[model samples]
Target: MVAVLARFLVPLNSLLAAGGARVSAAAESGKARHPLHAMVAKELRLWVATPTYLMNTAVGPALALLAAVSAAVAGPQALASAANVPGVDHDALAGLVSAAFPWVLGLCVAMTPLSASSVSLEGSARWVAQTAPVPSAAIVRSKVAANLLVAVPASLVAGVIASLSLAGGPADAALMVAAPVSCGLLASCLGVLLDARRPRFDWASAYEPVKRSANVAICVGAGVAASFAGGGATLLAGPCAGIAASMAMAALSVLAWKAASRVSLQDR
Candidate 1:
């Protein structure tokens, strides 16, 4: 439990501390606290400084280049064969992929275990944070923001590469990236909620959350849903669906955090 808590808490604390310090420096120098100021402050620093942020940003571009290289070396047919999924219009799919380069950026960031880390971070810092004047919602919001900051660039890079490589229309390409960033934000929020109830790192307790297939299914299902929605022929429905999904996820995350906050107080 201690180890589990440490792993979770240490990273979060470090992130918050670093972010807070930057914010503080700015505030001390001259800036006034803006609305959502604390959250924004934390987010900006983490985006530039965190490993997750860097990884998220890098993965999309790297993968896009690889996909492009593969397309170049193998040719369109080769690219189609590599895809292995039948019935897709090779050119259209390629176009879609190229246009959606930003999605890759989102993907890299979104793929991280945001949910898994939720409890560990909270558990580790619970004593201090709970005692502070800050609201639980504020803490939860900060986490969500931090993850979003990281995931946005990651998704953008990936989506752009995919979009540009495959010849996706500019609008389509933009959505490809935008949808993932929105979804990634939602996922990060959900993670916070999920963490609320997690038992302190007991292998048995941890396994249930870790091994659960529902999270994976939800993400995959979201993609499929987006695809179907896009096929509806409405101008923006598909992208809208992606955005809606992200909002839904974000809502869930908030609910989860609220619940967890209550639980924490009760336990105390």
Candidate 2:
């Protein structure tokens, strides 16, 4: 995994040191948000150029969604034939989707060779982004944007699959769809914040930081706990649960980003 990711990981390190990371002083007064636009564009370009970077997140979720659909298709018939078999009832679907929510979303953002490792991925070359003539906030926001670009669409698809499988009332169905999206928000924020706060610059392989690093574990752990709480609420109170969970995630995400925004990449 590290070798594959290292092949295309941020080939822009040189450009970052050159001029791509540069921003005009008047950019803040302009509509473009200057350096932020440049930084985000650079990250987006990397993904477009190295589509393989996304495979880790994409492959797993695709498989999970396929399994959920297959279960939904064969669930009723199998239950009719073998009463002792595992159930795929609405409640079962709800719990399954809820529990799986953050794990799936974490694939896109928190469990990273990307966002969670964006800073550390720079390795000894961290000076590129740090020396750029832009606020560290611009760099931070760019990472967040890059993460969301993948997470939003991917989470929506997963949620829709869960929603179809659940086949519940409007609120429950909506909750199924909303669950992954909110979890992604929380995961992304925590991933970025934790990585920024404690980065691993010296690594023999990118895989080491991703698996051996504390950021990924903490971020994923928090996501699972928060998501389980939300899922438990759904089990206890159907209607208000999803809304409350989504709102709580959104609020915490903002706070996390706020903390992350204050981090100085140059120092890390």
Determine which window of 10 residues in candidate 2 has minimal summed lDDT: 104-113
Question: How high a TM-score does candidate 1 get?
Answer: 0.55
Query: Which sections of candidate 1 miss by over 4 Å?
Result: 1-78, 84-107, 122-124, 199-268
TM-score between model 2 and native: 0.72
- Measured against the true structure, the TM-scores of the candidates, in listed sequence, are 0.55, 0.72
Best by TM-score: 2
lDDT of 1 by residue, 1-268 (tens): 2344345545766866876788779879998874455655544544434444333333433453454445445544555566667788886655444433334434444455344344443334456555756666666666656656555565565555555544335555556555556556545655555555443433333334334435433543454444344333223344445445445545654665566455452232
Each model's lDDT: 0.50, 0.63
Task: Give the lDDT of residue 140 in candidate 2.
Answer: 83
Residue 260: error of model 1 in Å? Answer: 6.7
